[model samples]
Target: MGAFSFLSRVLHTKPSNYSKILVLVSVSSGGLIAYAESHSNNETKIVEQSQPEPKRKRVVVLGTGWASISFLQDLDVSSYDVQVVSPRNYFAFTPLLPSVTCGTVEARSIVEPIRNILKKGNGKIHFWEAECLKIDAKEKKLHCRSNIDENLVGNNDFSLDYDYLIVAVGARVNTFNTPGVLEYCHFLKEVEDAQRIRRSVIDCFEKAVLPGLSEEERRTNLHFVIVGGGPTGIEFAAELHDFVHEDLVRIYPEVKDLAKITVIQSGDHILNTFDERISTFAERKFQRDGIEVLTGCRVVSVTDEFINMKVKATGENVKVPHGMVVWSTGVGTRPVVTDFMEQIGQTNRRALATDEWLRVKGCEGVYALGDCATVDQRKIMEDITSIFKAADKDNSGTLTVDEFEDVIEDIIISYPQVELYVKSKHLLEVVDLLRDYEGNKQGEIDIEGFKLALSHVDSQTKSLPATAQVAAQQGAYLSRCFNRWEQCKRNPEGPRHFKGSGRHEFRPFSYRHLGQFAPLGGDQAAAELPGDWVSMGRSTQWLWYSVYASKQVSWRTRILVVADWTRRYIFGRDSSRI
Candidate 1:
């Protein structure tokens, strides 16, 4: 009846109370209609008690990271009922996580609420702050659990259903099963994990300064050992180095030079994933800050007060005592993904097998995207030109968008992303859109006068990423897709093809890799910017700051980061933690 009523209904309050007033609206309208004030569609009819029909196809997407968010942004929202399920309601830009841990940037700057992104609801995409426990492919239902504290509230579990599903659950950091690792090693994967680490680092410095402690105990507590020389581990070690020099020495001179930070990586270099130049530069910087670079080292165990490591070069074991140890290795699949794959029995080589269209093999209404899916996209080789000829029934060669969508949808349902034809991208959009189309209950679609409408079938979460760019990109992509899907549904026969209306129109998703850059202290930094190997100092530091500043998510956030930097220049990085 009004905004208040919609709000009440959405909040699950007294919705009926507000809806009762709707009866009066029709009587008033009927009086106008009788006075020759009739609208074009209904010359004399009075409308009453009508609700917008809920779209039939429910599409559930997992994860709030780069892939899921991107898919949400780009999907046609008007055509289907869309829902996003994830642990965190906000999309965290992961690249800046290390800075947050070191107090260089506030944690809130890198996070954007999921609701804010979905406010432009083209097809009514909803948000669910929970983790998907399991998937029943046969029933098309998801078992989910809220990440919030349910014991405090006494209620939390729920289940959701979907007609089409996209699993974008990403990977988690892997620790290689090191002994005592789960018990003693802190991980820098999440914000809370970082804050806990920051406090622990500060606490250790103070304890080392206590007079009653023996030299061995003090050294053991003051030592900061970071295992894994990956980007996460290196950034953390560098930040700790700055905190000690910039704040620790001045605050507690008694323990000056007492704090030790070590980075142990298994490879010959750190950040092996990046250009060699970036890796070398990172090493020189680490050495300059008095942080140890123990390359070619393997961690054997993590104890309450020391880390047991092995020098791979010599096969000699080494023990480094420490108050806190952080493990920042790369990532691997999570339980939800593995178990679901096994249950489906369609997964091979530890990944979901999908054709070029991203459809799961041996399944219908199930799709896969992002890191969870290992789609080659090169396997598709259907002669799309033939599709033009195929849809040309009686050789007319004229195609309609509505007819095209039906043709392409039917074709893609049988074929996951496997053909060289999928490279056209427009074809991919057609296929992805078909994933949620609800009209074809028989799963058999035919476009009249279309030559290539007949087709065969094909097909295809874990967590959010550590980088914000990936998270944001995914958010934007998914949103766009939903928006377009909605638009297509409104005009089923419009220029947008539903089934080989002879038009090759569809949006394709593309990923642009941005090189890695993180802020290091005092005219020093490291960049893995799309090139060769070798460390650059002094010259690239300014460029590094520029990169970080430009990627602050928004102008307001950039301003906050700039202000924080300026204050740090004048006051130094704050080491005081109470």
Candidate 2:
């Protein structure tokens, strides 16, 4: 309906022009696109640019990511101003990022374009491809900076104002300040990271084929070193191992013999989050595949030439040169959160300290979720009578490992003869034949054996394996909360705000544990679902494919993904990298 609206649309499609438009338009307030036409009666009827009618409520969601996607799907947009802002314009199906790095899956295959996502909603959802740098709580506005490229916008920076805000910017790869790591090691947190890995890996191979290379020199030059024994690192290593064995030998035999891969883990065993049995299984499997698994090793420093790693076994340090070094350690708070905290003078250990409902403390009309914030899930922390602050927590919810230690003393008095065993024989697997996890990731209940063998049957459960299951479920949780919050706001007298926010008020969110799965490469996968179901091999992969197959954001995307998967299965990896 205004002058700037038309120009905005053009910039939306080809965002490279953002800077130039910003400079040209900065002379006026962000003018909306307007075109005037004269009527027969000398009256001008302005046809304002049309967008999907938004819901009555203004909900500006930051980060078009896992949590926001779920919220968008469930939100009745007819009542809210649903706006999404993020650096990337698409939702990257992160479980497949490792595959992207290994050249097994294309980056586009894992990314669902945001424009397509909104179109499928058939609603006018405003999108600002920018980073939210600040929040003016009193103004109830989101201050954002769009980095659409300086050449296009004349300046790389611009601002966006929003009404209600949801911060879902997820975590970033944490290096723990390892010396030289940030300078030399590559990370696997985004598509750019994956592309760089693939390109640099191939580039190294080409370099190794130089005319005057010695055998030892060539071998060291082609080695790949991976840090972290977590899911991402394990999965990437597995994919790389598969690529070398499956395609590299057949396609690039000249340097195949020189290719070596190693995984250095700081824990006693790989897959430390999984069951001990599973970790042992993975360790043996990696050993069998000629992949050096270095457990109990810490990386002290890394340089362009090689890395310095200390092993507890040798009680000394060692150095190894690698062509590619991928650091897949855990995640930490994102930059936006850190910046926000610094701006607000926050002292919470996390980027954003939130309540159970995921509302940022000291700020109203603003919420934070996903990896960027640390929510003391009021339900999970209600009982800490003498904790950091006055937050709602039931005594039951305040139970920590230290609190559990007190119970052991009482048990000792009740039953004098107490024997403790370290292992768990009661490993219960979920058996949901119809439900499948996205990555063949799994959830299993592993109960530890307790003392006082009178068969009282003590149990400790390790459920849902903190993999994609937790992430997906958390995403779904935020969606439900957003919808509920919108509804409660509309009614005003509606039952919202429960226990923690006030005295015996506010509804608590109960987390549901779903199944977990793991992709073991090639026509192979594994899943443990509810009801003691454990499946693997071709059958598991088929179910896994069909599960995520229906979860694509759009029908066109669904069809493309299916076609691509089938195409790859039949003809193999597109034989080209884009």
Candidate 3:
């Protein structure tokens, strides 16, 4: 009865006290729920913080020429933070530069802004209009100075750090230190150079028309002398011929008869790099076109009014008066490149030395290409040894000329870089020379003898032609290798590290020769296709146009170039100087 009375007292407690107990329970439940939610949010934040950011390597490109521009175009920017340092901010289509001097093409039409190219990349690319002064490979840094005039007083000098550096700063025209040559001659390596030549040509013509000038003086003022029978000099001579025949006949008829274009080649023939047949054809064409081509003549010196040449065969000296001279002889290493090579102990004095993979010798994380670099001879020797191993059926340790021919064929099949020489018949000549070597009396060459003979052959075929095509191919190749290397780094388990010494870790660069084409004035062009085929005439002229049009770097450039050509065809070139 007492327990029942206590239970009844508890059940009948006051309504206010009951409500207080209910509130306590509700508050405790709410607090526990809030704590649980807060803990969940904190855990999510921790996870978000723990996730890693994507890592990108830094790449520094050192030029704005064909090689550097093509590399930038092919680079996977998302994988790199790219910085470009160059004095110029645009890429000039060098193949068309000769046309610019003759007014067949405009200067601006052949240039593409470097900024526009970089903007097309996946990530933001930094560009500095500065000249690279020195590279501290040990520190992976570059010493650069602004090209802007206001910053020339050491104010805009700065240092840049990079994980990878590309040295593609191309070579400069070599004057051979000929006396007065630098003062009297003009070069054609840059847009400014072309502009200067055009201005000088026009000035010469204007001066020749002056009333006080005698016939001899007029002839002297109208003469155009070109040195170095390489493709550049030949092309310029052809263009000048067309300009004299087509434009000068109408604009300045008074000097047309006196105007003469002469190409002075130190070698036996102009276009000596091309096939002999092609060289013969070009010489014939020039002869028929009334352009004087003087071969086996070495220029001894140059003056403002005359050039003295020694006939290599007769040992006789001859002097030719000239109003203008264009020197397109060859290229030499820049002072900066020479300094860098010296610091790195590179043996190649003419250019930067690189391995088969285009990695600069003695410098890690640095690569070089274009006319500025030469691949190591040891790489070529290695390739030759591998080819010999494959071709040695009897394992005799010696190879005949026939076997060497087979080796050349094998190289053509395996390596694209040699395709140009092979297709152009240079490889066959190399084989012939090997067969005729005095040491190989029995017509069989031992390994060492083969290597010695090959060194000579390599001297003939080692460096690639310093053409825009070669540069572009090298640029694209390096970009691909870099992308693959980065991918390999990201995937450790996939294969060996890209830097490992595996035989196939990274493929060495091989350049495929597309073909060669040159416009010969008067709606005629000549082209040597891959293999033994050669084409010429008007149809080939159209082919030349189409090929160059297809090679235009951008759609805008293509349109501009086409429009410029069309305008020249319909309305003639604008001869007015700006």
Candidate 4:
């Protein structure tokens, strides 16, 4: 009763005191809310800062040739940490290498630095100017050695770890263990090789004009012999002819009539890879240009002064005197590549064998392409058989037209090479033709008939040619597949659409042959383009220029090529030795 009476008296004491107390309570509540909000914001930022960054996979690419460069250009580097190892630090534009030998184009103009190319990428990329010595596939590592001069101060050997490995080390010139070939012959495969050839040609011209020289000596000094009938050999011969006629004739008249160019080919015809019409055309052009094309001849031995050949038609040994011999007799697997294949237990002796997806056989996380690898056709046949069995459903040994259609669809999804063949009505007609099989008592398409159908598709999708177009396409396809795989890994629940389908599967590589072109002398060229775009002469020459100019790997290189062409046109080739 006393406490109630005291509270009633205090409540009635003053209205001003009650208002001040209420204001103080409200201020304290506002301070408490502000502190709580500030603490929550600070905690959220702290948590974000403490979280770890996602790790990236390591991708190591071997060689900086056409295949490797194309893959690097198309790859999404942000998804992986990339490292490139090669004996060369720059990518040489091989097609223009012939021009370098005669000074039609500068050697440096065709070479692009690998570091410069990597600078254009969004992710960090490391480059090592080294040669890969061995591949430890079981450990996912590569043993490499410095290719730089031994006099230089640097680590001589090192090992690199990789989650993925790309083997693109290209082939080396094949001498077939011929005596004196490697020591005496000049190969036009690199920049230094072209420079050496140029110097040798100039030296030959200078020696031929020397006073008191015998007729035989002069003739031998001015003769240039090229071994091989491939595109490289033919193109080099053409360039040499142009250099002699257009430039050397004006500069050195004393030995003008002494120079001779000869090409020895083992095949029945030069440019045998081309169509018969094109081959005949090229041969006739060579004949008119005074460039002798000796078909059906195999080089037996090479010496400092002469090359001995065995003529197939005559079966007689012939010795041709020459001041310079250029060996472009095709390529063979390098020692490193051969060793890697052997170490990996790959059965292909000529090159590394790969499945249809370009994955190296008998190895994981390893892939091979370019001239170093060949697709295993037997494995592809086995895959085709598995696909056929899958479509047979109900454990039946034979299939109907509808079942065949299902198989075709499945193949189209898995093997992009057969997509074009399968999508057309021609495939349906093929199936209909196979429906009338006499051996099948069930009146259905038997396994033999399926195999026949696959054989037809196989012809269309067999081994791809070892060409720049095929290499570039393969690199692009692999890049796309890797990128898709990375994305699918990040999102396990995603569609997992990769090369063609799910995460575990990859679409077989499909090579599209764009065209083939070769330069003839006197501002003329020849091209066998797809469809009906066959062309030759000056028009084809311009087409060649435009195609190569646009195809230059970088804008800087394209500009330099254009400038070089213009300079050559205005001033003629620089014949003076550098």
Candidate 5:
């Protein structure tokens, strides 16, 4: 019969006057298979059109920070029901937070609404503007409270049940229990904090220019003391210097020379986390810019008028007057995270601990990313016995050179430290680690020999830095794992199993360092790229601008940031308090 005749027979009627006709055709070994359907405006009924859909697991994400936002952006939400809860509904590009502090970039230009991010996908994702008060890991529930309007209703608190929870709420500024520090020092952690610092900077200049102010008083008021000479503090000092000499000095020339910027660091050098060359360059640049960098000094007490410090080298106390103090020391755990940590028996740990896969060790179905967690790498010595057994495929008590070579790839993939160890020791090959003390390379090795070879490998295990780069990479890694959760369950794709028979369901999380950048004042910057490459100077400053503009979460923010930078260059930073 003809194709039209077969289609008419399948439909059980002529296809004439049909409003819609659906045909699905597939070629099989026997013959062509076709599915035909006809719909009439009058009385046609679809044959069993409705089918049940598999229930999707609920994934509750906490925070709108780098890790959480990156996770949401990459996650396959069609596979899981996702809901985000955060006190702030917008994601801020935190790396540029220092720029925000001095109006080098506006705060609004660095933030994007969470809802706007979700609108890019077809999946329906819910967001609640609330803070997670408590996480009940035992019951898999969350207690959240909305701070929007607490007085309008009864109990602004609610509970949510989740199959999986992602904790990415970032850390709070650390004050280190210093007296009067929290009350007087300004922080640069959030957008609001930056705005506050900006207004304060203007206020310091305004008060200095007031009539009847003595030179000493004017100097004191114009003094800007920054605590903790980390990246945030250094950048702020640089930005403030530019704002002073470039813009503010032109407006208030009387107190311009009196304006002084001092950086107090407990460490021996500013940007100690950076390369020594970069740190030296930063210090020298600051000195040339007339920014005083006081190293080997610790701030013990900070008052409104005086900042008390004890010199680590001299053990002598010194008091310095300041108009404003900005604290960019470091991050500490949040209260909610602290409570959650206590519940999970992570009392001694500063940040939540996760296995190599990013799964919380004590709690099931819970994961952590960002500065709020650290990956606890398994020591090779702990698994040395199982590794030996796995390599001994012939049920022998020893491993030959061929046996060891067979599993070398899996070993490297499973424990990255093995490769690092070999490279650091300057060995020709990783297999050389198995050589006996007397120098026998191509020989059989017992369990003792295997243990000895890998015993020092654990020393190469280092925790990843808590940088935005690390957090973003971790978020992407976890999203890929979640996307393939079901597929990997049936067919494990991890490295070869050393403990048992089959491979792990998914590969462990691995971090690849991209690079880091530090912007010094005077249109100069420094970058530490991969492979120990360092670049600095005006060219690096342009690189910094390009990298920062490109790293914006949305093109709207990107354009806004670039516009802000251009506006600053053409008109100078907006020194108005507003």
Candidate 6:
């Protein structure tokens, strides 16, 4: 065993102080191999320390979203001074946000206090309820303001200096520069936003029931419009349909037929990112539910009581009156991230660019994840020559089948796109790509031929979608990297290089897609699992319930969510406007 390991085992103390002693003792260099014992009055003690302990690195994390929370939960805080800052003090389960809008699940049941999450981990992680305003990349400082003290203080602003900064603040709602969207539309990006939407939904029904309104006015007042037919918009429309038919119609029996829900999609179909079968099924279900789906149409503007759109197929201008509008199109970068990008010379980019290792390009000791950043996956074509040269060990101009086989694993590890390309082509192995069209299994190829064979691999490169699953996985991967940072620095642990000599210090981040769920309401759902498995219907809805309940951050939350679902089933969703 190494001296540090020996000292750590003998001490049996907390890792914070234990790591400090290991740093002070020159343990890895053999200075603390022997522990001298001193005796007095029949008592024994270890040798006295001759040097002071070095300070740990300060790691500042911004945001309490899925990414940041995952990082904190998995990180070993014994070696670093970790501090978390965000406007909210809780981590919300955002997948159930549509349910919250219709009271299927209470908002509080879906959120876990950041403090509670931290307490379950190492007690060293600290949190602050504040917002990050600016990032000084050159100086490694952050300008922040307290969210709670903004109303009482002269200036709630403060600064933080960090050795390493983690940017996971997530993105903001994108209005797409559409006119009047900011002033008239409600968004469903947060818990508070869902609560506001619920209140507005109740207000719409109450106003339509008022005696002063005519039949035309009542119809206009009861119309609900949702812009953007993505997963969020589709799910919201389904939930609203269920809410109205299952509950609201019974309460307001006079204007039962007046309620109308419409979904506007710029794309040809709702849930375009999902499987085509799933998308078709959703459209059919919505059609059967009397929900109007306007496909291939873009919203030009939204007013207080009207939304204007242009039909793509016929170039027809369409105008519709609505009581309320919910905007769930896409996400945009925050001001702080935009400013940081400019500081680091990343201009005209929608999101921050990061290396495959999750490190921000052109910056040192800083990393970004979640919706605010996109990984710039390296292309295989960029290093084709180096790879070919490295594989040709005998200085031969042509590479044989054996030589190609030896380096194929390394190539797949270093560049994931190669594996994806092989899968896309329905090939069993990467070596199959080396074969000719005549089904030649064994052959020798020159550099030019090798380049031609792999040229199309780069076309398979695609960006990861900004989702909670991606962010959570990224956080866990980064925490593992940080936990083993010192060990990996001393001895590289990643796969051997296909372009160079020595192995890489760490493996690049790769996303593992377990599966995704689309709840279609009315005891029905759809799921796209790994290995091209697609499932739909009531059984899938039960699976969705089990999966979401199990994925909660805490058992308290898991139980609460399950209880809320049970309560909603036993006694329909609480329709109180509160």
TM per model? 0.71, 0.72, 0.79, 0.84, 0.88, 0.90
Better of 4 and 6 by TM-score: 6
Better of 1 and 6 by lDDT: 6
lDDT of 4 by residue, 238-262 (tens): 9999999988988889778989999
Scored against the true structure, residue 13 in model 1 reaches a CA lDDT of 37
What local distance difference test score does each model get?
A: 0.65, 0.64, 0.79, 0.79, 0.86, 0.87
Those runs of model 5 whose alpha carbons end farther than 4 Å from true positions after fitting are: 1-51, 151-155, 436-442, 490-496, 499-505
What digit string (tens of lDDT, one per residue) describes model 1 on residues 259-294?
788888889998786677677767777787788889
Query: After superposing candidate 4, which stretches have Cα over 4 Å from the reference?
Result: 1-50, 378-385, 393-398, 412-444, 455-462, 490-505
Clash counts for all predictions = 99, 56, 0, 0, 0, 0
Highest TM-score among the candidates is held by which one?
6
- Rank the models by TM-score, top first: 6, 5, 4, 3, 2, 1
Best by lDDT: 6
Writing each residue's lDDT as its tens digit, candidate 6 over 344-444 gives 99989989999888888998889998999999988888889889999999988989988998888878888888888998999977788788878787579
Q: Tell me the RMSD of model 4 versus the true structure.
A: 9.7
lDDT of 3 by residue, 395-415 (tens): 999887777776665454334
- lDDT by residue for model 2 (446-502), tens: 111111212332232122222444545555666665565565544211233222333
| lDDT at residue 569 of model 5 (Cα atoms) | 90
Q: lDDT score, residue 239, model 1?
A: 77
Where is the poorest 10-residue window by lDDT in model 3? 20-29
